[model samples]
Target chain A: MKIGAVIKISGLNKDFPGGVRALRGVSLEVRAGEFLLMLGSSGAGKSTLLRCINGLVAPTSGRVELNGVPVGAGVKNISLREQRKSVGMIFQQFNLVRRLRVLDNVLCGRLYYNPLLSSCFNIFPQRDVQFALSCLERVGLREKAYQRADTLSGGQQQRVGIARALVQQPQVILADEPVASLDPKSARTVMDILREINQQDGITVIASLHDVDLALEYARRVVGVREGAVVVDKAAVKLTPKDIENIYGGAKEQEVYDGTYGRLEYVRA
Target chain B: MSELKRPVLPPTDRDGRRQSGLEKLLYLQRALIIGFVLAVYLWSARGTNLSLPELIEGFPHMADFFSRMLPPNLAILKDLVRPTVETVQIALWGTSLAVLLAIPLGLLAARNIAPHPTLYATARFILNALRSISEMVFALIFVTAVGLGPFPGVLALAFHSAGMLGKFYAEAIENIDPGVVEALEATGAHKLQVIAFGVVPQVLPEFIAYNLYRLEHNVRQATVLGLVGAGGIGFELITSMRLFKYPDTAAILMMILATVTLVDYLSSRLRARVI
Candidate 1:
């Protein structure tokens, strides 16, 4: 809606080949340097929306604009790849090349800038390697840089994921349920790292989260989706229980909305 | 409180039978399969005029021939050494050439990695055509074309093994984890880069293992390729047998066996280490 919005989705709709309507005419704007949390049930189009931003899943109709450039269905492969370079993605599974060393997995983020021959031989420049090591250091995983990525704990693997994204030097990071596979403590640690990245580095972060309390604690802004449409959009502090009720209608009350504000106190204490 | 408790048992049919209709049918089917196999074996034995008495009568002749070829003609071992080394060389060269040709074909034939359906189908068709012809048949053709030598033997092995290795490579590529590929693609890597960083690392060890297996197989095939005059130890065995030099024939056979055994051991060890 704003003139200088970093990511703009307008009337975006994505219908999968099997006729599943994952998104329906969704419109949203993400400001630069904001930590935006998207809340939704399993099939509520949150992941699809994030994928659309990076051109991973092409939208069926309408458009998604990133930094004033159109990126969606019908964009050229070269331009789409260029657009993807500025939009880092972190997955719930921490999808590192499991057999490779942690440093090599993190260096994958710099593949766009490296020459084809160098990337094939895994010969990154010294500066890029140092930068990757620093990103690992920032995530408290500098010691595990030489270890195989699969040998680490779940939280440690996610920290590697963050380090990989950070190596891209991206303007925006899209984390699709980054902590859904972690225990509560590890989830909190990942959220803290993402928040630190957002606040300290001024990187725009759009994270889709399942936990309401975590979203409220870490997000500057929260957008709620129901079925395939946004149902609520508000600043985190101004979010109300009634808005959550509309988003999760007909689901089990206690499981979906019961622990909304209670976990905040637990996290604080 | 004084009464003893009884454990509950599973319910049965009204007739109190343990076997169900499905179980009865399964038993009948198994019995029928066994009977059919027995009948086929008996019919084939009768048709081929197989006689136990004839086999017993032939044992003495086999023993006589073995006795004539006794001691393995160890003095001729040096003469047989060069041919054995040539056979192994043929196998090594053939397998290396096959690997070179198979890599591109396999990349094109793999469904997930192929850029277009037409390319995939064409590559698959070529591979199948290559596989349909036996290695011995190819050896015969190449021997005719090249006028007889280890060159023809090598060519035959390379062409035939390429078909097999290419199919295996395609399967390995298709089976790799898609998430890793997606992660690479999300980082703005090009198509070739995705394949190099994502697909190659996942499949390299398996490709190497398969190549080693093919090398072992090709070594055995190379020994036999010379039977059709493509030039190897088989040529020596055939000549010695034709000339009635039983001792020399025995030496050549032993040499072939030893070479194949060594190749098998080395390939298995390499595969164990790689995988």
Candidate 2:
């Protein structure tokens, strides 16, 4: 395992309290500038794998090396939080502090760098504020920076979440089901923004997705997990309906495979 | 489908008898709770030397005092005004000092802002110690140290109120949304910054309201401390009582009641606006 491979994992195992094994001997490599989609059903260890990479959840056994720094080992372990600052994460819930102004929420990305006095004063250096504004403009929410975060629509809140991550200037962005709470239109918009961030800015994006079409459309590479094991790892162009069926399993009413199923059922109901 | 025969047995246990067991258990539980409450009340009363018969016997004295309070002392109003203003001053100064002292104590006692367990626990212990002593006891001690004056009364109210408000402020800090704190932390702000940005804003309104309440409470306590020679309207009232000038004492009581009502109204309005 050459350290030059960037973010590398080997024999990662995690068993939560009560002996629920979320990940077992999970091993993978995430190269620089790679848009990797960690695909999985509920309880399939995709989130745990992401959490382990950033040190949010420690792996019971195994080594995660990020940028040649050892993670999840003793007191000297690479502080995933410091690493997390460099590598931004977005949640399925958007996770914005609703009472705060959108600009303040976005500026939280710089929390790891600012002093208490500075943050309290909110005297973000003009450059930092400019950067945050530019990030907002990228996500098309520049006008809403002064508004309370809770006032925004679901789509806008998710965009604000993206802007928050962007202000971190992350090398890698891990989005745990980023579009799970959005409508189909909003999901597409968020996915497009992620793809743009990946393509234009050259930031690596690894997002978890349940929608196979979404993963297919946005991700360059999709790694499927089932029961805490990576079952399928392939380029998007190589993925087939058969491979997806293998991922979701064979107990659906047929239309679940099609992208319009979520929309159609609600319309009919 | 032909001829079928049915046999019936005699009713053995009464339905009421079955339910009586449950009813008995409930009654026993209720009696146990009532007995426990009474036992606790009696135990505390005995320790405090608060005897019912003593209180009953004092009713006659209370009647005598009220009779002396008749034919309202309107003439004494001019004399009472000066002492009344002194009482208000004591409360105002006491509340201001408490507010100042409580700011640091409250932050230290707050679970989120304390950062270290030892520091937090120490702050909490100190606050608890301050709050455990009654304000009158505090006044007595401070009066000995500083020499009997409204200064001692003010100090006593400040220390006691700070203890109470510190605990409340800490609890308010604890109840805030952790998500906001985490966000502030993520910004690379120091512990103090997190408290300033994340914890303070959430609890400001509550802190303001609590301070107003403490001010209102201190006014009443200031009157009582005056009886211990802490200097206020109570000092004048106590002199009249000692001199058997019941009409003058009645005048002071009326002033105290009016002052209390006015302070209460103002505090409620302030609290309402804060909310």
lDDT of 2: 0.79
- On a 0 to 100 scale, what is the lDDT of residue A58 in model 2? 66
Position A149, candidate 2: lDDT: 92
Candidate 1 per-residue lDDT, tens place, B1-275, comes to 25778986667565556678998999999999999999999999999999999999999999999888876777888988888889999999999999999999999998878887799899999899888988899999999998888999999999999999999999999898876777777787778888888898899899999999999999999898888988778888888888888998888888888999999998999999989
| lDDT (tens digit, per residue) of candidate 2 on A157-262 | 9999899888988888888789999999999999999999998987888888988878887788999976667878899889888878777766543321222112
Q: What does candidate 2's lDDT look like per residue over B182-209, in tens digits?
A: 5444433456666666777678889899
Question: TM-score for model 2?
Answer: 0.78
lDDT tens digits, residue span A1-269, model 1: 23369998899887765456778889999888989999988768787788788877777798999877798343544487788888899988888888889999999999998899878888999999999999999999999999999999999999998998899899999998999999999999999999999989989999999899899899889999876789899899999998888777667422222212121111111
C-alpha lDDT of all candidate models, in order = 0.86, 0.79
Fnat computed for model 2: 0.25
Give the runs in model 1 whose Cα sits over 4 Å from its true position.
A1-3, A72-78, A252-269, B1-10, B13-61
Regions of model 2 farther than 4 Å from truth = A1-6, A13-23, A41-48, A57-63, A71-82, A211-213, A225-233, A237-269, B1-60, B71-93, B96-114, B187-189, B229-231
